[model samples]
Target chain A: MSVAMPPGSAFLPLSVSLRGARLVYDDLLLFDGLDLELVGGSLTCLLGPSGIGKSSLLRLLAGLAPRGMSGHLHDGSGQSLRHQVAYMAQQDLLLPWLSVLDNVLLGSRLRGEPPDRSRALDLLARVGLTEVAHSRPAALSGGMRQRAALARTLMEQRPLVLMDEPFSGLDALTRLRLQDLAAELLAGCTVLLVTHDPLEALRLGEHILVMNGRPATLSALPELPGAPPRDPGDPALQAAYRAILRQLDAGSR
Target chain B: MKARLWRALLTLAGLLLVWQGVVMLGDLPPYIMPDPLAVGVRLWRDAGLLLGHAAVTALEIVLGMLLGTVLGVLSALALGYSRRARRWLLPVLIASQAVPVFALAPLLVLWLGYGMGSKIAMAMLVIYFPVTANFYDGLRHTPGGWLDLARVMAPEGRRWAVLWHIAIPAALPAFGSGLRVAAAVAPIGAVLGEWVGASAGLGYLMLQANSRMQIDLLFAALLVLAVLAVGLYFLVDAGLRRLLPWHPANPATLENG
Candidate 1:
């Protein structure tokens, strides 16, 4: 059930444009004067090497950007952003003490909704985790935990989701399954994903932004060519991956 | 399982043998180092009176634990969320503990008189520290991701519900440890207060028996105190396991899960 948008509140669409964003830490510039836009209802993946501020950019967008950063996001709709965003951190961040179902229902609990246990159950089933709903994160395999985290992110009914290497530690098959699941659930929302894998960026991202350090900046933003839930072997994905890799390799040199 | 049971039995036998050997070798006198069997016999003979005293002590311990837990949680919540309160109150709490229970016991007895009141007060004091520290630390260390989730999830309304539903459950493990530590230390405080001055209780009984050179009875009382402490600790531990059944320590099987 969609909650009534608060009175005198503005609703920010899924689109986000970062104008002249910069961030610094301890006299070191993580990102400087970066400009980017994530079109509404699309998945944008930030792909780059380690220490390239990909995650830092995601953090900035989440409004949790650490001290010493300035950025303004211009949503297509003139309304200010509401609290319609969910974040999946680098770690699974599942409460180890809670069952998988309970963890998924956590967002509902925090939202003061009568924990939609059925939503949690359905999300678990979508991730092929119905059998493990009552299991703890610690008891489940790594992939299962990630799936649970994904379920939690989706259960929030947010319009925007930020994922930081959400599938980093999973095996290839598990990663593919989760990638599909994410695309399905977030069909109508925007996603900002940060990852190091070109394949992951190509597999899931509609727009790919490659970043680099030493005055971190976006090296490339390749427009992917495919429909929703693109296949791995799509010709456009291969072309985009190759083009993005050249920019990344050229930047490293 | 067999190995653990065997190890436990061996350890018990070893302890029993050491006690017997000590009594035989010391042979100083029955009034001083009574044999384990003599201690057991004395315990059996006075079981009725000892049980009565034990019941009172147990009641004081349970009540004090409940009171101390409530105080600890309230103080932890206040201190954890408020920086100014933490700065002022935390030091006072530490300083309070520095004045050892033994030194304060007599004063407590004089103030409250020789009743259960002084013992419960002592127990509350002893149990308060671990509970406060552990709970406060837990609340302070709740994962940042969860808080962020709460903010995003409840932007429209119901802030308190978010904190209680998200933050409190996240801190349960630390809360469990705090209570367990507090429960373990609680009995010691009660016994110490009883020692200072009491007309009844196992601690008082031990003092009386010791003064009369009934060493076996004193030992019996000491054993009962140890058992009570262990029992209380395990009871809290069991409760923690039951509450957080999905905790890593007790991995739920597929059926239970």
Candidate 2:
């Protein structure tokens, strides 16, 4: 389904820089003076082994990093990045009580702003969730629930989106479809996606970064050719995948 | 549903048979422990008197539940929303539970008089804690993911939005639990107040029947009170189920269906 962009929905994408980021969890350093940067309006996939503070780095960018994690986050606009960011987590996190439509409008409702119902419905329709807009999240399938979550994230109309393994919970087929939908919907917005899957990164990321080791540091791999939602069977993508696997394997040791 | 009802009826029948067996085996006098049959006969004979007293007690319990729930919800919201209120009111709320309602019954009667007012207050006092404590716990324990979502979604200085849209709704099932416990114990406060000082209610009837050695009538009163408490509990449970359609009390049953 072709997703229609909401009227006047163009966003000025924000480039974020995190420097001297230090996180000590239970006295074990996670990120010691780590530095990273995101190019404006590009999807950057961060792959790391479990417990390597991948999610924490995304949280730091979303301004939700745990207390005692010292860092400087510059959005290059001399403004706080909090208002400019939208976050999507592994779980759909749709409030069970709210209908799909209400969940889409949640960002507006939470901000105490008047919700544009027609716009929310339009977003839902784009995500192919028009029929179940009035149904509760409990009534939705995992894929449909994430679609609704994506709609909610889009409703925020933020320039920077940080997603932590947002599609990892879905079945392979559903996850692949959602990656395409997310790529199409999140175009022109700077995104930091943290994932454990190499293929997911190869399929969606414009720039792939691997974070590994004690006091984890980020290393950039060569940028993939062509746009995201690239074919998984493509030889270049397969080659990138093997390289990422080797990098992750080396990081573990 | 039909099967459930049948099982409930069977259980009641079994309990009644046990009561009758005990009385018969003990060769108990009617004054000491009237047979189940005697209690049933007394219930039929004094149906009008029993119903009147029951109405009084039921009224007290219902009114008390309403007042207590309102106060409890307000206090929960206060405690959930304000750090200052949580610091000051939480201690007071906990202390209120520590003071037994039985000890407070006499004071309630003295202050609110030997009428429905005292009984209602006693019932309210009995139930207020469960409702407040349960709801506050619910508010405090809103899922971390949801709160994180709210922190990102809601504008700064609009904490009320998060509490209203997310925390309160998330906490409702817990609040419903508190309400159920409150409903079960509501009768205790009202009955205690009646026993302490009252001219009406089943509790008062129970007291008078005991004094007059009408053990069967006393047993009849007790039966009606049990029916009232159980009936009220089911009523509350049913109402809550309807109100919170999103919160399935038994997800397994719902899934099976």
Candidate 3:
């Protein structure tokens, strides 16, 4: 069976391989000799207990690690992701002065490219924020703000997306809906989402990368080949969640 | 807004009544402190002369504010951009404030002469520190999360692009606070400079009235100066509110589904 993708959204799937990332902060080695490889065009949900350096890996992949980080991270094309990535930070980080529409178009504006207003508007509509497109970020609800942030991430039109707990603060229902939306919009693009919720990981991730230990280590759990995001109530998905938790439990020791 | 305005008017009226009572009960002569009515009458009768002097004082204060704001912004940008420069220059800028700026008034009048230049210089000096310090603090405190987002958006070695888009806008509210403080204190500089030496402005007029024993006009000039200071502050505050429309305190809008 073939996967159905969005109309006019054909993008080359990218695979990323990170080797020997040595990330240290103030004499504390957060990550050392950390090697990770991401499946091409797949959603990789990285789950870790607090402070396991999951975000450091994403920073390295996105070429945003601190200046002195010693590592080599290459994508499928063997090229730098320095200009090929989009990131959604934990905070919405929307420029407060700009309207919601302008915040989504910020990446293009910063690059001096004429804003693709039609595309931004389309993304805004898809995210269900059409009416408040002219509203300031301070005027948006928490869920709506994160949706706008999600739209901005998609607006970059980058092959790879790095998201750090993009929907952690949302209500449960809102988080579930956004998970579905993110999966739909980011179907063809490679994505690495950092999250703490196990059910969220089971719902969205095609491959579960469990992180543990200081100078963090990564271990991949077994996965079902069904397309995400699967039903959080699906028995198969729940079984997969149990397996992931077990793997995490074993890896901790 | 109406309630707030009424509250302020009530407060002013109550203060004036107490002052009038003090003058009447204490049997203080008008020479020591003119009654509020006398001051008001003097204000109305000398409105034309007061307006002219007010115009001059207003011009000096406005020019000083503009210069100080521009210089302070430039200095903030410089300090924001260069850590090395900040390490050396920031202390020097702070140290300059320790030397009583009032002490510089006579020297400014002697050097720049008894004109608008000296008064403007004093006002500029008074306003420079708050603007620079607040702006620099704002720049330094840009959220780390925003910087990370900026880095990913335009990691093209485009420092100016990052600063213009993210750093400046984020820092503006703090900078606007500095401007408000500057506006509140701006009149002091011009008036002080005039008191040291000047041919025009309300401060100069008040000094002349004091020596000539025209205490009523002196109090009138003081009243006019107070009105101007309060008015300037409100104007600046209103302008800043307009500039920062997204005050981070608006009622949250629902996400249209």
Candidate 4:
């Protein structure tokens, strides 16, 4: 059964804008005067080369930017939005001992709110993991583990979700399936997905941003026709992929 | 598992046989190296008295281990969370270990008196270092990615919640390893305390038998002590394995973990 979020229970969509974010690690200038914004309730894809600071930018937006960064992340509401974020890192950081269902409920448990098991189980079903709800993370395959992590991210009910190469480790088939599921499940939430695959970005992003340079800059790509889980085999997506690849190659040089 | 147990039993029997042969061959007096049969007879005859002393030693070990584990966890928390504690208390803790810890037995007995309190304190002293060192290493060395995720989840920056959820759970296997080391060495502290001043426990019995020239009975007390140490170790190992079932059950896992 599809679990509709109870009225007034789901988070109100948040708009995030970062201005003059200055993050330097050790001696390397990661971001100097970087500015970006995520329109409320939209999935924004970030694409770049291996080390072009896309993930770092996401961290900056989440207010988890590295220490000694001078910047303001204004949640257009003029308030701290850190508590409203859910981050899915490159590695599925599922607690090893917690069962799949409990892992999904971790955010609520941490907040001292009683877990809504029905909602968690419904999310697990959406991820096609109903069978392993009672299993520990180590018992699941790599793809299943990531699925479990995705379920956990969804359970947080947060409006702002930051994902860093979340599906890059999966096989192509599982990756495609997860991309479709994520696009559908996170419909009205603000999402920033960091990925290396241009096609995956074209398939899932409403508005894609390519970040590159010594001090980092974010430039937007044109919006595609429809919200994604867009047809990966479509000609338009292929053209966008080719154009984005060229943009990334040019950025690296 | 059954095969390993059988092999272990075989090895023990072979060692006993060799000991009997060596005693017969060397024509050694019973006072120097009593035959295994004589020791076994003494064990059977004095089982009641030996058990009473064994009970005291076991109690002291259990009490000290519980106290050590709690204190060690607290100290490790301080070391992990605070730079000042890391700098000042860490060196003091290490320096305490530098002087032979067993040498503190006499002073502990004098201070705490010749009772279970001194023995328990001695065991705590011996048990604290490894637990603190291993647990602190685990807490400080959590993966960067996990820490970042923890930060993102708790935007209020609830440091203790992050530590309880992410840091402590991640550090559990290391804590388990520390406890195992503590269990193996637990008997040492209690026996040392008894040697210093106690009138009860296996150590006192061993000393009494030694002075009376009851070699077989001394061997019996030594065997009882060995069994207690081995039993306690296995108990801790079994409990830890249950607690951390997700831990890879292999020799390589332990080496890395």
Q: What interface RMSD does each of the candidate structures achieve?
A: 2.1, 1.1, 1.2, 1.5
Provide the clashing-pair count of each candidate structure.
0, 0, 0, 0
DockQ of each: 0.57, 0.77, 0.71, 0.56
Q: For model 2, what fraction of the real interface contacts is kept? A: 0.74
For candidate 1, lDDT tens digit of each residue in B1-257? Answer: 58767998899789989999998987758887888899889889999988888888898899889999999999988887678988999899888878876688889999999999999999988888899989888888888877765665666656567557766776777888899889888998899989999988889998998898888888988888877888898788878888987555443343355
How many Å off is the CA of B121 in candidate 3? Answer: 0.8
Error of 4 at B182 (Å): 0.6
lDDT of 3 by residue, B65-182 (tens): 9999999999999999988879988999989989999999999999999989999999999999999999988998988887788778888857787788888988998999899999
Structure candidate 4, residue pairs in collision: none
Error of 3 at A73 (Å): 0.7
Candidate 2 colliding pairs? none
State the DockQ, from 0 to 1, for candidate 4.
0.56
Consecutive 10-residue window with the lowest summed lDDT within model 4 chain B = B247-256
Better of 1 and 2 by lDDT: 2
TM-score for each predicted model, relative to the true structure: 0.90, 0.95, 0.94, 0.92
Considering just the first chain, candidate 3 attains a TM-score of 0.92
Candidate 4 Cα outliers beyond 4 Å, as residue runs: A1-12, B81-88, B249-257
Return the lDDT, model 1, position A170: 87
Cα lDDT over the full model 1? 0.80
Off by over 4 Å in 1: A1-13, A222-224, A228-242, B1-10, B156-159, B249-257
Better by TM-score, candidate 4 or 3: 3
